[model samples]
Target chain A: MPAVIADGLVKSFGDTEALRGVSFEIERASVLCVLGPNGAGKTTAVRILTTLLRPDAGRAVVDGIDVVADPRGARARIGLTGQYAAVDERLTGFENLQLVGRLFHMRTAQARSRARELLERFSLTDAGDRAVKGYSGGMRRRLDIAMSLIADPSVLFLDEPTTGLDPRSRLQMWDVIDGLVADGTTLLLTTQYLDEAERLADDIVVIDNGSVIARGTATQLKSASGGDRVEVTVSDRDDVDRVPVVLAGSLQAGVEPVLDHAARQATLPMSSTDHVVPRVVRSLDEAGIDVVDVVVRRPTLDDVFLQLTGHRAENDTDADDDDSTSAAVPEGAAR
Target chain B: MTATATPTRSGPVPSDRHVVPTGATWLARDTWTEATRHLTATRRNPELLVFATIQPIMFVVLFVYVFGGAIQIPGFASYEQFVVPGIFAQTIVFGSAFTGIGIAEDMSKGFIDRLRSLPMYPSAVLLGRTFSDLLRNIFTFFIMLIVGLFVGFRLEGGLVDAALATLLLLAFAYAFSWIQALIGLSVKSVETANSAGFMWMFPLTFISSAFVDPSTMPGWLQPVAEHNPFTIVTNATRALYNGYDPGMDVVWSLVWAAGITVVFAALSFRKFTSNSK
Candidate 1:
């Protein structure tokens, strides 16, 4: 069985449906990256998987344990690090780990030894005796992750682990995650950073409006949407109106020039390099049209998201908040 | 679904045992840690330590010396004897408000969220807090006991009765801390929990027979004053101090303590779990 399986998951908070029929699977020992904007059912999904919240409908299994029926069993096997660091401010870094160890039923001496080991592993041995309130944000986050691993849970859920960290700190956190993956831990990470997902996830699941809009490897999703995109910038604003006439014959039967007058650029969709760019350049040259620049680029995750959902990933604040809610995309748009 | 897939050795395999630490044990350890930490922090700030210790002492002196002259109890030999135990109960009960205020501070600082995420026993949050407050109450009780002894108050009851009296007072105070825990968990702000906890406590203390004999009160208010939990506890403590057998009131006070602990614990647990959801 897969390490994690969620089927027909539906959740609603009062009048708002946070998740609607969301489903996915994470293979054992693989990193499954859940990507979406804020308010995307990412946090909600994490909460349910962690046994912190119960879904109103649908069933989920973690490590072959039913989440709803055997939540405690599931909880025992899973580790969760929420968006905010949950370390005790009053306890020193060592004490926080010790406390968690004790809670996990380890003997006092065992807990102490484990605490020391973790303190050293997280590079917090020097500050182990100091109160967490004295630690920096990055240090606290590291400690929070250490606390979660005290029990050595099989499944790990990290919700926006690097949301507020600096680039350096973010990279540091990524390295820690990489280390965990190397240890054969099944990780389910929720992130808004496309690069983070592309670099870390073995499989990517894109959720919008509380539903899985797209799911596949990064290359597969991008290629499925369109392999290549050619953008043309006109030399003059007045020349933008002539784009359609200039490239009319070279364009594919279904391909249309998307003119953005304000930006003085026109985008042409193409399946492959082939003769499309050459044909367009020949046609524009024959019309005495001066082209500033023309470039072909592979489809990014953002483009796939925009094409499949009809909304830019970053600018859609609504998708950010209601990440699990299904977006009302325009009909006949890029799937 | 591939049923025969080998159980991979990637991450640590968690146990099937659904073990959760008991509420009492979890709270005892966590609260001790937190209380000691708070005490350490307070110890560093001499001003805070001075104020925390002095405020209860001031209450002891003001109530026994200043108010003793103006009041008289029909059966009691001296007002000092009657007022000292009352003040002890009042001071400890009032101190219980810190449980809620401390929780509020933790909530505001996001410390409560951190605690919630841990696999620790769920009740540990409130239990550790209340237990810590109970320790502080014990210290406050002793300080007042010494002050009471200096002011001509004597424990008529033998060592056992005196010990029982102390235990009863601490139990009641500990129970009251749970009430504060509920408030801390529900209130919007730590300052609000501070004021609101004290506001509610003042009336509970005043309405009881903490200050004077229930017989001395008007006929209309007699029943409430008689049945109030604080009344039973104070009367039991006074009886113990005066060397008189407290009889049924002691048992009733214990019952009240146990009942309140269970009820408030359940309520706080419900509030905590729901908030996380």
Candidate 2:
């Protein structure tokens, strides 16, 4: 059975319709990344799937059990790491994990043993005895993940777990997540970070304005956005208008170039970036078009996002740049 | 159905056998776990325990020492003796607000989300909070008694009545806790939780028979104070503690306790179920 399935999930928070008939699934032991911008119902979808939300007009089945019908059943087989670290600042890392263990009804000895095991796995053994207030952001996040993993859940729901971490910390968290996936746990993660979706997601579902707009593998999505292509910025700024006509004419009988006048660049949609470059260059020479620079670019998920949603993801990477630029950033910005 | 699709790699067959007890057993365990967690924090945060202790003592000193000389009870030997029940009523009433603050803190801090995602128990968080605060109230009652004894507060109703008074106060506090829990769950923010938690306290406690005999109040406010639950408990506790006519106060105290507990517990549970989800 599939680990998770959400169909036409709908939810509203007062006047805001947070999830508008959104749907997706995670196959057992594979990652399904719910990729979206902030406030795009990513968390809402995870919340519904994790049984923390009851969708207004949809269904969620986890491990073959309907979530709304049996939230306790769904919860038993799933682990969730919310946007916040959720670690008790006053409690030691070990104590935090131990508390979760006991909350899960593990015996005291079993809880302690599991706490130590998770502490070791998360590389927090030394810091385990220290209050979580003393932990670095990454350490706290690790503890949060460890707490989620205490029950060894079959399906894991991580709702933007690394959304506020520094790059190094983000990577460390990614490593921990990678380890869990490697151990054969299915993961349903939500993120606004395109790279995070690309890096770890086996399949991606792009959600926007409380709906799923696109779903596919990363490669499929990038190509669907418009595949690998050559971008030519003409040497003479005025020649930009003529370049597309010249190139579309010489390259193929049916090809068309999408031109950006402001940038003075014409982007040729090509089957392969490198394979078509030589032929395009020969045609450009024949047409006597002098180019300032011609480079083949592989479309990133951001490109897919722009194609699907018609806007850039106001994301972690750009926000991180602004944050490190000025120390006035009181806390890490959310992705 | 997005989830009904094929599995790429099915997880191992029941890799971790869940032998977890369900129903009441799981709930009791979960509640106990949360109670211990709160108790641990109470122990580690010496400042909080000290503050919890000092605030009530300060109230006792202020009311008995500063305000005592002017205030008189016709049938009482001393103001301090008459004020002990009032102090008990006020202490536990205010202490009940901590339930709301704690619930709100858990929500803002995301601990409620963590607990919700687990399968062990549904009412565990609420019950655990009430349980822990009850323990603290018990502690506060003991402290207030020790300090009351020093200030010449006597128990003329004898030991059995005193023990019964303590139990009534605890029950009253437990009932009030559910009211706070509802506020906390509704507010769901640490800042708002505090204001919302204590918002009803001033009007509820100040207008009651806790501090003074409701007969001394102006006619307009006297009825409200007399019928108020805070006044009911305080009156009952005073009767039970000072060897007075235990009468309707005892019946009304338990009735109010049972009524508030059942009503607010149901209301809070309903809100908590939907809100947490």
Query: Where does model 2 exceed 4 Å of error?
Result: A12-17, A228-271, A275-301, A309-335, B1-16
Q: Which whole-number lDDT from 0 to 100 does residue A13 have in model 1?
A: 91
lDDT of 2 at A266: 77
- Tens-digit per-residue lDDT, A1-335, candidate 1: 99899898888998888999889999999999998877779988888887777898998899898888876567667878888887777668987887776656555665677788778878899999998879988898899888888777778888889887877788789888998899898999998765678778899999987999989987777666555666677788887778876666444454345677666777766645677667667777788878887766555545667778877666244345533211222110111
Put down candidate 2 lDDT per residue, B44-66, tens digits, no spaces. Answer: 77876986799888888889998
Candidate 1, residues B49-103: lDDT per residue as tens digits?
A: 5655788789878888888899998768899888888988888988888888888
By summed lDDT, the worst window of 10 consecutive residues in model 1 chain B runs over B1-10
| A1-335: candidate 2 lDDT, tens digit per residue | 77888999989888999988987778888999988878889888888888888889998999888989888877877889999999888789999999987776565666788889899989999999988888998998899999998877878889988877898898898899899878888999887766677788999999888988999988888777777657787777778888767666433233346567666777665665555667777777787888777776555445566677776555545643432111112123322
TM-score of each: 0.78, 0.86
Docking class of 1: acceptable
